[model samples]
Target: MPCDQDKLAIDDSRWQVAVAREAVIRPLINAGQLSPIDVATACRILGLRRSRLYALIEQYRSAPVTSSLAAARPGPKKGARRLAVEVEAAIEEAIRDKYLTRQKASVSTLHDHIRHLCRERGLDIPSWKAVRARVEQIDRFKLVRQREGNKAARDRLRPVPEEYRADHALQIVQIDHTRVDLFVVDTIYRLPIQRPWLTLAIDVASRIVVGFYLSLEAPSSASVALAIHHAVMPKAEWLLARGIELDWPVSGLPDIIHVDNAREFRARALARGAAEYGISLLHRPVATPHYGGHIERLIGTMMGAVHMLPGTTFSSISERGDYDPERHAVMTIEELERWLTLEIVGRYHNEVHSSLQMPPNAAWREALDRRRAPFRHPHDDQQFFYDFLPFEERSIRRDGVHIFGLRYWDDVLSPWAGRLDRQLRVKYDPRDLSCVFVEGPDGAHWPIRYADLRRPRITLGEHRLAQAALRQRGVRLTDEQLIFDTVEAQRELLETSASITKSARRQVARRARSLNAADQGAAAEVVAPGTKDEPETLPVLAVEEWS
Candidate 1:
């Protein structure tokens, strides 16, 4: 019945009583009164009683009706008006000067410029949002004309062209400089700090870091050359002491040295070095990195290890002073060096490669075993870098050495390059054979006379000599053989180790579980069920109320 109220009201809307009640209510309200007759008529029209109508009106009146006929009022504080005078001035200046006209400048760029201007004037700049608001107030419909062209085309792909090898081992050693973030000790300051430098190296068959140079700056041709020397050199002194005497250069003279387009790699010194070693040098494309993928991967591996070192920061060694044992880990430089050579390198060589399926050392040894007898690592290419690469020592002149037209006079380099040709060693990277590095007596090496630095190119013929010396005692391999063997070895090692370790873990877990179950069962038998360990009971208190 209650739900039928709307239906009853609708039905009453068609009755004559409803029309009469609607017409009579206006006059009664004009008289500022509601008569019984009017109330009765309204009740009948609306399908309710007179008392109910009066009660409903009172109830609704007390139910809080909001005033709908009120005048509009302003909202809460609309916030302080921003100062756009400076922004307007800047925009006008930009427009007048043609620095920017029809094209709209980004809010961020505007903010940055405004901030820079404020900094120059020693004035505080407003927040970025305020700056943006000002810009919007001035010209919200501004359009920025963007230059259209292939950005990818601007950066040509320069990949190190891969050289074809016929066999495994040292067939084609790829060399590249990877900028690694690392902490180096500033010997002068005796503090630990972070520094980035060029890590140059050759990736032998097993992707081992056969040779590398860690410097505080981008590597020079000489640094690259030194890395090559290390690559060809015998195992580190510590490794040799530990009795790891196996013929190296096992694969052979790298028939081709692959490198990126860095000036060091293209230097004459490096080219001469490679030529002397009977190794052809190849340069990568302008921007493509995948051409020399192995060396790139090796760089990643090296940096990964570097990241694991503690207290590493992003700074230069010269700025922070020599690595402080107190600040860094408690390892001395010699100790750290030893660890790197013996532990890191040793582990790396011995670890089974995911791609090669064999340890680098194993692959190297196998290549050696397959080589021409006497099992001696070849010396044929050892002198290639060592002899042909030029080392010059130059002091920092009042005017720095003009390398490719740029003046590089770092305070650190100033101490070394101040003098004229003060006997610095300059070695070139073989890949490009156009750039040479100035090597200092303090073992600091960097690219010398880079094209950007405006250094004149020395003639290659001056350094060119016959590849007279063949490696009398090392294994030689074709490029193809090297890659196949190395890859096969890595794959084999990864799959084999995974399988063996997984099975061994499963067996050990199963055995341990069985032993645990048996022990539990035996222990259970010795324990008696339903032992008489009675629960403690509390005494009940008798309550008495005495009058």
Candidate 2:
């Protein structure tokens, strides 16, 4: 007879029996060498015939859950009801409005409510057993969420397995941030600064690295945006710009981006951008580290490879007893980035993954072959990149929009000027504050530059530093000119002291990164279509040989 697994309910005795059978059968199945003696012992322990025990083992092998092993009783279907349609409707309404509430009403209270409704409507009351069966049909997760709270439901009902699984590439991608275990020097001064943070995304199915972004700044919404942008866009031009000959073909929008409950991951910009591109953001339950095991393990593997470099901290202080990472740090941040790219594309992708039992590149290609369809790419690369930028809402005055004490104005702002009914959204890139993209009323982003075109471009970090310096001098009310002047003065100070002070050197490195981004943008404009250029090679850094 066909059984409805969804409606089936096993009593405590059957559930306990299933659990006992699972304890004996699971290990034998995992061993893969079941002997007659083993089967006989299991049958004796479970008090079942040989044929029955074999059937149960096959059932358990198909689905290792305890519920799969529960015996189905041959009787009226557990939730099959012969009641009138109106009576069923009343019971459902009562359960929803009265039983599933914060008041934590009991079954008897719910029965009374249903009795009153039935009496009012001139319908027969449902039996207590029928009402209880219907209540049991309610999803446990939803029931817990309604009676208890979200946190309690999440903690109690989350999947118990440690590994998160995906069937194909780009189905589930996990993103995370970690501080690199090696120190990198400033580009100009060649002095050690703090370790850069790396934001990485990995495809869970193939265990391939989709994209990564490294920055001297701590993890933030901007870093997450940039990392995701890199993951979605094609990497041919990016790789060419870095002079890498290796192929990194992993690029596309993931169906679900699994992340932890960090503030940056919960940012409005990320959530909205993901929704715009038809991507779902899945946040693991709070404090569940194993839920993100794939990304965490990838980070560990990358860090292990980093320890082979010249200035590695070796994961812990005890491991670095007599070594000095800062003094030995010879590679600049740019060099470190290039080295990491090489490691990811040239080495990591080609090596056999322990979990997949094949090279990640091989797994990716095989998955694509089976699907027989090309991966989805962004329709407009530039528009896709701009969509993830951090934004703010501001009203446009006759002069223009004001952001971070700087006035941005363009001819496009003339139509929406001095409008009090609504404020336009302005999106800015953290790497360059020279211009901001304003979303007009017509649902288009218009680029607006500084009102004073002669003013130089400054990074968001530099702008903040300038504001801090002005505050130190007790300048409460400052204009754009004052802010720019302070920024220029700070740049001069950093240049002069960069070689001696670590903080100054770090600031210089950050500024270099900002300028590098701008330079890349300019270079992309001059390059002809379908043409490649030889990028200038950076100086090679020393590395100790791995045994």
Candidate 3:
């Protein structure tokens, strides 16, 4: 049988194409310009059978070219389309409305619905196979997305080829925060703390990890600023401090930092500080995972490395079942910090990146060598530190400057004390509640310590937590009350163990950090030991802020 002789459905436009080919070849056969074998070859090209070729040739001699090329009318042409137009309309409507809405409905269900709908309309019905064929024509992507949701849509959208091309390093950088999937102990207490949070910055072009801040404290503006500060400055001092000899050449003020819409990223302090340095922040769209994928992948890599160490809270319950992370934990936060630094600078940087098919260090060096633009940093480290501190406007009262619930005073503030007309601008580090800086109308900043200097320093977070804890105990602490009680609260948490009570993980981490401080030296302020959560923000002010 020839291809044209075995006719397809009239609705299949290919049938008309076959008919047109026969029309074109019939004239050649009739004009005697072609021999029987030649005609047979032409019919073969036209997909006409030998018998069909002779029939079409005879029909073509008596009919117009247009008539010969037309496909025969399909269905019982004498009746109403083999089924009423209303019945076909009902089947189509059932497919779009009934079949598409169901997530797991089969074609048989669609066929039954079509017949049911046709019966209600008092119209003729088509075969179940005909209705099932209509199901095949449904657009799966659109149907699945409507029934299943964006996640289904997103899965199909992935494996998208890379259209992004890069010319320079830091053309765009992505940043994200993740709580490490591992439990680490305190250097002093040896008690496992909550998994530390890591704020990582990644350079897109070189696939270089610019810098990261790890803290026992939750994700906050201070940690982000600390990370960005390290990102923008020279790595020599940092690398030297870590006693690391490896070259970490990737450091510069990125023009833009892409991050999620976290409260930390939207912090006014970060915004103001970034604006000063001409760095803009772009917030990734909510629920859009791909936007921050670079840093996310880097985090996964870091976490994967950490999982090999003892105390890892391996990602899933199945992986972690019967495994005790706290009991198995060995490294302290600071040790992990150092270990992660070595991994990033030594292993991660030296290893080949998937995107560039070259080591990150090499890519960074290549970009730098190609363009020797001067590396930009703040003129002064202290100033860069100050620029990132959270600030607010407050009027100086006779009692001196009070923020939240604590009073800050310096004899230097004696002059500004009792002055109500002046709304002085004040900058504060939340990590320490012991002191604050007040911007005098004379363009000078006065450093004011807590009115009671004898008291041990505590962080604003610790202070707030203490006050809340005290309130729960029906005790209200006033400025006149012994401020040292708050410091005791800090110690109570730091000195306590979670081995028995299994206290809240965050509190356990807070306590461990405080103990580490005491071990290092019970200074007015204790600096957390740095970890892969790098850029350990030391206590410039008394008190401790846990990661």
Best by TM-score: 2
**Across residues 1-547, which tens digit of lDDT does each residue of candidate 3 receive?**
0112212123335444644564465447436655787777767787768877667666544432222444567555322235567776888788778776746677787778777877787777788877766666565666776667768865874334354334577767788889998887755557676688888888887888898877788888877777887787778866776688887777666757888878888786676556444455677655778877788889889989988999998878898889999888888777777798999988999898887899998898787665433444554454455566677878788878877667777667777787645477787766555667776654345567777666555666667777776777777755534335765755566556444343444565665464443233212222222212222233456668899
Global lDDT of each model? 0.45, 0.80, 0.67
* lDDT comparison, 2 vs 3, better candidate: 2
Tens digits of per-residue lDDT for model 1 on 1-547? 0111111112222323323332333334434567777777666766776765565455323321111111122353123243466644654453333323434456777677777766675556767786655444342112222222234333343232356332445556788775544444432233443343545455555465566544433466756665666666554452565355533332234546778877778676576445433456777665676677787777666656655676443235674456552356333233344455554455777788777899777776675555442311334332233444554434456654432213344333466554544434444333222244454443334443332232222222111211111112243422323333443443345345533443332222222322332232211112112233222223445668999
lDDT of 1 at 406: 30
Backbone clash total for model 2 is 0
Cα lDDT of model 2 by residue, 1-547, tens digit: 1112211145545656766776677667766888999999999999999999989888765544444577886787443447899999999999999988989889989999999999999999888888887888787878998999888898898756556788788988999999999999887767798899999999988899999999998888888988898888778988998898888998887878999989899887676556444466888876888899999999999999999998899999999999999999988888888999999999999999998899999999876665533455555455556567778888899999999999998776787889646676788888888778786654455677788777787889999999998999999999999999999998999899988899998998898887577557521222222344434333445668999
Better by lDDT, candidate 3 or 1: 3
Cα RMSD for candidate 2?
18.0
In model 1, where is the ten-residue run with the lowest total lDDT? Answer: 1-10
- TM-score of every model? 0.38, 0.68, 0.61
Q: Candidate order by TM-score, highest to lowest?
A: 2, 3, 1
The best-first sequence of candidates by lDDT reads 2, 3, 1
The segments of candidate 2 whose C-alpha lies over 4 angstroms from its true place after superposition are: 1-163, 372-374, 521-547
Hey, what RMSD does candidate 3 come out at? Answer: 25.2
